[model samples]
Structure formats: C-alpha cells, structure tokens
Target: MVSRRGTKSKTPGSKRTSANPPSRKQFNPSLHRFQERYEQKEFQAKPHGIPVRVLSFMGVTVLAMSMYSGYLYASYQREVSKAQSLDVPRDVSDRYNSTAPTFDAEVELSEKAMRLGKKRGDLIRLARGDVLEVSCGTGRNLEYYDLGERRGTDDQGHAAVIGCRSLTFVDLSPQMVDITREKFQAANPEFTHVAFRAQDAGAVTVEAPARVRDLAGAGKDASDHRAYYDTIVQTMGLCSMADPVGTLRHLGEITEPERGRILLLEHGRSHYDWLNRILDNLAPLHADKHGCWWNRDIGAIVEESGLEVVEVKRWHFGTTWRYVLRPKILCGEKK
Candidate 1:
C-alpha cells in the first residue's frame, strides 16, 4: 500500500501502477472476407472480359467471311458448270470461217453494248424463271440472270423450271456459243447448269427440230409445258435476221401462253432528225463496214407482231439508236 500524501509516493520497493494498454478494435471477419472476394473477382473479371469480347468479335467476323466465301464459291461453281455443259455445233467452225467479223472490232462493240445495257438495268430486272436468251453470244448476260436466288420449292424441293429455273443461252454461231461457254466456265464453274444451244433465232423450227420432236413425243403434259421457256430475250439479233418480224411472231407463238415475257435490246432507226439524216447519209458505207442496217424500225416490227409493249426505252450511242422493249399480252392473256 502507498502513503496518501501528495508527494509521498509508493514505498521504494513497491511496484509502480502500470497504465492500461489501449484495447485493440476487433476486426470484422465478414467485411474482410467480402473485400478479399471483391478484389479476387475484379482481378478475374478483368482477364475474362477482354477475351470474351475479342472472341465474340472474332466469331462474328469469321462467320461473315465464311458466308461471303460460300456465296463466291457458289457463284464460281455455277459459272464453271455452265461452261462445261455448253455445246457448240460443228457448223460454227464453218460460219466463223466464212463471215466472221473482225475479232477486235466485235469485242470493242460488244463491250460498249454491255456497258450501256448494264446502265439500263432492264436486263437484270426482266430475266426470270425459264429464260430464253436469243443470240446469247458468249453468255455475257449470265451475270444478270439470278439463278441461285429463286424462292419456294417443289414437292421434291427439286426446283421447277417455270418458277425456279434461270437463263438458257441460244446462238446461231457455234463459235460464239463455244467462246461464251468457255468464258462463263472460267468465271463461274457452278453455273454449268445453264444450257447453251446452237440454233438460228429466226428459224427455230429448222434449228432444233430434233429437240422439238422430242418434246412433242413427250405428249401434252403440263410438265412438258413447264420444261419449255417462260421468257424470250433478244439482244442485237433482229437486225441481222432475214425476217425480224416473222421471227418475233414465231417466238410469240412458241412462248408459254400466259407467262411469256419478251425482253428486246435492239439497235434500230433513230427518232432524232439530225441523227437520222446522218444515218441515211452513211447507210451505204455503214452497211459495207459493219453488216448492220440502220434503217429498220425494230420497235414498229415488235408492236405489229401481236406482242403488247410493256415498256420502251430508247438509247443513242453516237449514230446508233437502241431500244429496250418489254412485251406481253394484257392481263397475262395468251396471244
């Protein structure tokens, strides 16, 4: 015990009273655990988010690329298939030998025609179903014929010709057909299904009588009719024909009654007075240089051939006048 005096203090041997140590605040175990988990979660989440996002984007890109590749492959295959199946008649060699135009000049002119035709967009819009392309020349218009995009299905899902088929190319010049076949084959291997026939546009009866006979032999079934074409396309062919009007009439007669649509791209008489005068003056020289007669009014001939004109567009390149005509009977009526 210590004395009570203010300065007395404890006895010399007595132990001094120690100050109490500050009590430690108890730690919250649950809060510490929560903080540890949050930090761990943040660390883990940072690594996963970037990879997940990158992987997702990569997946989308790969899918898009795959789809595009498939589309290109299909298109290429179609073209190649068309080329392999193309048939050029033996008569083509003789014709090419006899009256073949200058290759360079023909190519240049054809390129010009294709460029102009593409701008019109009528060719692309008009080609559908069982298409018959007359004077098809090397199947340059095959790109315009959309074959892979047909909708719906048959009982067997094996596309119907009338409702699902694409373009058929026909030409009088066997050489022309062969060249076209090769070109398309090189470009689109899959489209080999497109048929190419060497035959006269004006005299279809004389050209492919065997095919016609075979069809007649097949009897008068609707399937046989479906096997026939639903549309006719004439491109720069009528001018060279012996009888343009008669040929148009014949085509009209053979087309499927109510479904036939005729799309014509022909160069003919100019309506422009000045241009017509120039054509008239150059007629003899033009005919001698390029076996093409500029005086025929192809539009008038088509109108008179019992085909109702659906649309008529005129294009003038230099002195040449071209007409794009869509012909059909009113209300899908048969001619």
Candidate 2:
C-alpha cells in the first residue's frame, strides 16, 4: 500500500499485501462446474447454404409425414382384410332433391376458385341443334350458353341458332329440375322451345323438341328438325348415376348417329397413384355429403360406354375430365 506521502509500505494489514493481491473476479459456481463437452451432434452441423432452423423444420416435417404414411398403410391393410357384406344401395338423386336450394351456394365458391366456369363453357359452347343436357342441376351452365344466334349448321347438318335449335334439361330431382326451370325461364323468357323434365335421365325416353326457329315459323314445321339429339351433354353427372356406363350408352343411342357429339365434363380419379389412394379413401364420405363418387375411374367408364372418343383432355392432376365423344356405330373411326 502507498501512504498518503506516496511511499510503499510493508505492513501486514496493508491493503496491497500479496495475501489479498489484486481483487480477482468473483468465482461463479456455474462457470466452475465440471463439464465434459468435448464434442456434440449439434457441433458437427455446419452451414451448407441452408439455415439450422430450416434444417430442423425439414427434419421434423419428414418424420411426421413418414409416420402418417405408415398409419395410412396400416389402415389400408385392415380395410383389405375386412369381409364384404350387402350394403344398402345409395341413390344420390334422392339426396340432390334436398340439396337443391342451396346447392349452388354450397359449391359455387370452390368452383369459382378452381375456374370451373371456363371448363363448363368449353363444353356448353360445343353444343348444337336439339341438345339434351342430362342431370342439369340448377341450370349452372345456362349463363354460359352464348345466346347470340349461331350462324353455322349443326353437326347433323341442321341449321342452328340461339346456341341450339332446341334445349332440353333433365334431372332425377323434381326440386332440382324446378330450380333449373326457374333459372332458365328468368334468363331466357323469349325462348319457349326449351323443355324441362324431372325424371331419371337413364330411364326417360326424351321427347324430341321443336326447333326454336320453328316456333316463330318462318314457314317451317315445328317438327321439321325433330329427331334424336344432335349433341348430348352431361357435366358432373356420371359419378352420381346408378348405371354410368348404361346411361352413357343410352345417350349414345339417342344421339344423331354419324355427326352427333357427347360433351362431358366430370371429376374422378387422379393420374398419380398417391393421389388416387387419397381420393379412394375420401370417396365414401364425399359421396355421402356431395352425392357423387369423386374417385370413380372415368376413363374406364367412358371406355365401357363404347362411345368413340372424338377428343379427351384432363386437368387438375387428371381428376377433372373433358371429353368429346361420338356414336361408335356410325362413327366407326375416330376423326
């Protein structure tokens, strides 16, 4: 210790004595605790253009997905081992009668999000003289109909106008058909040639309609162009039909043989196996709620229908189908 006179002192009680020395930092018990961290798994990790938090999240996601896949596999095995029993048949049309009023509200948002209107228009615009639209629920495609006079002849070589020479709407649900009727009438008050039938499309022998042009008669007979339809259209109808293949075949039989077309837009199984599996698992619940089997093999159904495929296209991982078909009998070769 230095005295006030700045002289060094050797006293035993001096503050600067070697016994106390300079005050060292207070020893912390936690810092002094013994540890054996020579190396660790985390320490081995190094930057490889990806962040550590991202890598951790990726690892967790992979683990969770693996566990989920295993669970699904086990579920499938159990399902396969289960014995078959007589299940009560489902009639989706009956369900549609109840769903008629709010059906558009229920599905419109999702359809708009998916841009389904464009797909519907694509099929509806291809229609020609004496068209039959089977299972036309709530007239969803009515607005899509280009009502301006058609300047061209139909596939069957009949003069056509106002989108079609005549239009027929059919559905199994009376309520649904009624709604369709109201919609069409409100939109096309001047067009009285359109017909609405509340009967199973598969069972009904559709009455041929008078030409829209004939109603005003420019000296033409009402039945001048009366015959089987020049074009048959069904959108999202097959999945709910009890006999899809038979119904398609029936429609083909009623279509004008050589030049008639069947335009269909439907939803079903996907192109990928994984997606198909998911669809199959979800189908029963979907059918119960939406009255449609969304996982049916549409391509297979069309093949079994035995119609000549004029054109076939798919979208949304092949779950959505757009088809143009002709009668196989007269149109022996696809054009």
Candidate 3:
C-alpha cells in the first residue's frame, strides 16, 4: 500500500523508454522517400508507353513485308532485263537456221490453226489439183487432196483427172518427211505417186536450163521455168521462214503467170490500236520466251515483196490475217 501511493501505477499504456529504440518520425520519413524514388525509377524505365510484346510484333511484321517487296522487285527486274536482251538484232538467215528444227513444234501449233474458224475453211476451199504442200508435217492436210486423181484411178477403177495427179510433200526436217511419208502410205497404200522431200523452201529451183526445159516440157530456159508452181499454199509457214518477205518474193517468182495463186494464212500485227500497243510493249518478252519475233509486221512485209494483195481479211478481231496475193509481175508475163 505504501509503494502504490508513492510510485506511478503500472499499466499497459504506460510509456517505456529504451536506450536503442528506433525513432518513429524519422523512420516514416525515410520509408516515404524510398517509395517516391521507386515510383520515379519505374516511370523513367517505361519511356515508350507501349508493351514490349506489341512493339516486337510490329517490328517483325514490318521487316517481313520489306523483305517480300524486295524479292518481288528483284524478280521483276530480272525478267525486264531478259526481255531487253532479246532486242539485240539477229540476221534473218541466222534466225531461220536456228529455228528450222523447231518445225516439229510449229506443226502442233498449225493443228491449232485449223480451229481458228471460217478463214481455214475458206483456205481449204481454195486448195486443189497437183498439190505441192510445203511444210507438210505428218501429211495432216494430204487427205484434202483428191487421192483418186493422184492415183489415176477412182475407187470404182475409173481414171479421173478431178483427183490430184501428184502430191509432193516437202519439209525441212527428214524426220517430219519420214513421218509424213508413212502417214500417206498408210492412208493410200495403192497410191504410189506421192513423193516426200526434205528440202528448204528457199532452195527450191531447177539447177539448169536443160532441167527446167525437161520439167516444163517446153523449150524454155531455166529462167522461163521460174513460173512453175500452179498454186502456193502457205499455212502458218511464213512466220517460221528466215526471211518471210524474201520467201514470198521467191514464191512469187516461181508461181505460174496469172494462173497461180499465192494463198496465205498468217498471224500478224493487231489491227486494234490498243491491242497493238500492248503487243508492242510485250514483244520483247514474248519473242524471248517463244523464239518468235512479234515485231515483224507480216502484212506490210508481204505487200513490200511485189505481191498484190487481192484480199486481206482479219480473222478473230485481228489475231490473224488471211491474204490472197498475186505477183505484181508474173514470170514469163509482161508487167
């Protein structure tokens, strides 16, 4: 009782003092400063204000697009370069020599020409007797010739002149000539008059005046025998010639005076201005790819070859042209 009255009563709230106790006010101030510093560091680190994943994805997408575009541009440049290179000049004779063996390929394309429409039918209608089919591959058009007349006997064992008397199939390739011979033989085993020759069209000529006179059955010189071919049928053949214009001129020289007809089925310059423009633009590429020279205007060249264009008809809106040309001065005839 005496102690309680003298000393302060001991309680839970009573303040206790320690020699090494932490200072509350100072501790709180230090903690607040640490928190503010941490926030400042975080704000400084996040400068871009975008998520790292989103930025990385965008960067990769841009890089891929750039690479793809570059590849496409490079490919286009390569093709253009190739096209330009084909623009270099090549001699017509050299081109013909290089392309002569490609007749096999041309034959397949000629078959497609049959489907070109009424122009083909019109051409076949104009074809007739003692036919000399140049570039006759596999004898595809030989059936059109009159076999009875060619054989001098009809199916009824009657002699006839209405049928072809002779069919001379000529081509540049021996393989093509052999194939044509077999096809004709198989078709007409009894017809022994069919002949096949592997010869160049540009080289067809009587060697001397005696040979020409014998061939003509006339007392004419080799120059007089220049007018020999009754009719010249050219179907998709001129384009493949080394010098198409020169070839036409030679054909004109060989054709019979006024009697012979030079019939042609050719694909040439487009009539439509827009189409021609496009063709001209793509000529280099097309020629390089196909080994064809689209730059040559066949019609213009043919006309320049002393051929009188009797008819010039455009087939299929300008994809092809069919012409019937007569020589300006027929051989053995005065101009």
Best by TM-score: 2
lDDT for every model? 0.60, 0.80, 0.63
Task: Report the Cα lDDT for residue 292, model 2.
Answer: 86
- Tens-digit lDDT track for model 3 on 1-335? 23656975667787888889785754678889999999999998776778889999999999999999999878867766676676544333233334445645764676576465355556755544545666554455655554544335534777633455456677666776787788788879997655678777766652211112233344545354342555566666665566777778877776654555678877767768877765665567755444455556777888688888888787655767788877786467542
Best by lDDT: 2
RMSD in angstroms between candidate 3 and the native structure over all alpha carbons: 18.7
lDDT pick, better of 1 and 2:
2
In candidate 2, position 40 carries an lDDT of: 46
Better of 2 and 3 by TM-score: 2
For model 2, state the Cα shift of residue 123 in Å.
1.3
Clashes per model (N, Cα, C within 3 A)? 16, 0, 2
Model 3 score (lDDT): 0.63
* Candidate 1 residue-wise lDDT, 265-314, digit = tens: 77777777776665555544444444455556776787787766666667
| TM-score list, all predictions | 0.55, 0.68, 0.57
Worst 10 residues of 1 by lDDT: 205-214
Model 1 residue 88 distance off true place after TM-score fit, in angstroms: 28
